[model samples]
Target: MQKRILLSLIVLLGACSTEKPDTVSIESQDDMKHASSVAANSTENREEVSLSLLEKSDSKYSYKLNGMKFSSNDRVLKKGSVVQSLSESGSGLIKGSFVVIASQLPKGVIEHYEVNEIATSTYRLIPLEIGGDLYELYQALRQNDVFSRVEIEIDYSGKQTSDSF
Candidate 1:
């Protein structure tokens, strides 16, 4: 009887210990809840844009991202990939103190994107500015304790125009 009571208490405490899920649980493609079973529609050796990494900063950090939006008629990004990071020279001021990737996306649409969740209230969104940034997607990946990999999607439907409007 004592053993039974102890086992019951242990199970009860285990259930209440920690139930929260990890933030970066989507490391593998199998983790995708609704991956498009309709084979990806892309091409080979196609012309694609490249993104440059933002330069490193010297002083204190500034700017907390609120929202990010990137849409191109040619390709749409998945819900967990990070948009390519802009080279420090590209942004001109803010450097590589922070980065962003996709956490939630609307639907199948834009081709390239990099969105990362820095904190509860802050998120970095990288929407490709031009076609040249596509090739640079791999370079943007930064292996860190917080961020593991930048998830993305590539679409080659022959349309290169970004859906900003």
Candidate 2:
């Protein structure tokens, strides 16, 4: 009887220690399904949508600012900065990292700006500086004739996937 009781206690402890966490949240399931379907459609019709705009992530808004919920963990602007929404900008220019492609890489661009070259003429501008707002930076780069196009780099840091799975 003593041995049986000890064995039962050990098994109970082992079971508790090996318990799995609940990974699925029904609240975000619809968002995930919509995103996946959009991805499938994009693959079928390449030109129908811009591939650069599609992003997959599981991050949720923890708080609200100015009555708007920001999904990204990394806030692109300074802590106290007021974010201008699409209505205000009239261009849907939300704050985030952007990929700036230019016809020519201008001189002295690295002095006040830090960028990572992704391809021959493609460069990624990381929005880490206090004054490095995406819209403002794009405008600044656009003043020079060297820049051809500026696009927002989709933030995908919110996607949750397990390495063991």
Candidate 3:
């Protein structure tokens, strides 16, 4: 009886120790292909455009790139009707800041900037007080080739008021 029990234990242990061949599920394989294709298409569509500084003053600066206007004031970066408000009234000041809307951002750029993800693929980037200038950040974004659209806020002279948050 002892010999039989010992043999049974050895057989059970041997079966448990056997290694199965490494395999990936079909769903995971399909997912990987889809991700790679998306990345490839995004890189293929990337094109560099000339970013020109239009005007600069003590309080604000205006820039133009590919027929889109961008303006930055003491607090926020504006593009078209979208205003990415960086600081609230009486809050700490933010400088050398901007917004980038893209499907994906590089790991290095994400580490360098103080990022706020306002929505899916939309990011508000605030630079540190000492380093990472606005133009440098913009160039980084362009180099990464992730942005679907370049939309910068244009200031309107008409008075505007917001009653709801």
In model 2, state the lDDT of residue 37: 96
Name the top lDDT candidate: 2
- Candidate 2 overall Cα lDDT vs. reference? 0.53
If candidate 2 were superposed on the true structure by all CA atoms, what would the RMSD be? Answer: 18.9
If scored against the real structure, what TM-score would every candidate get? 0.19, 0.35, 0.35
Clashes of 3: 5
Q: Kindly list the per-residue Cα lDDT of model 2 for residues 41-137, writing each as its tens digit.
A: 8787875444333432333212233333334333444322333333333112233455667866676676655678999889876544655545456
lDDT tens digits, residue span 35-83, model 1 = 4332232221121211112122222222212122332222322222223
Judging by lDDT, tell me the better candidate of 2 and 3.
2
**Model 2: runs farther than 4 Å from truth?**
1-95, 156-165
Candidate 3 structure quality by residue, lDDT tens digits, 16-65: 86688789564687799988898887766552211222232434554443
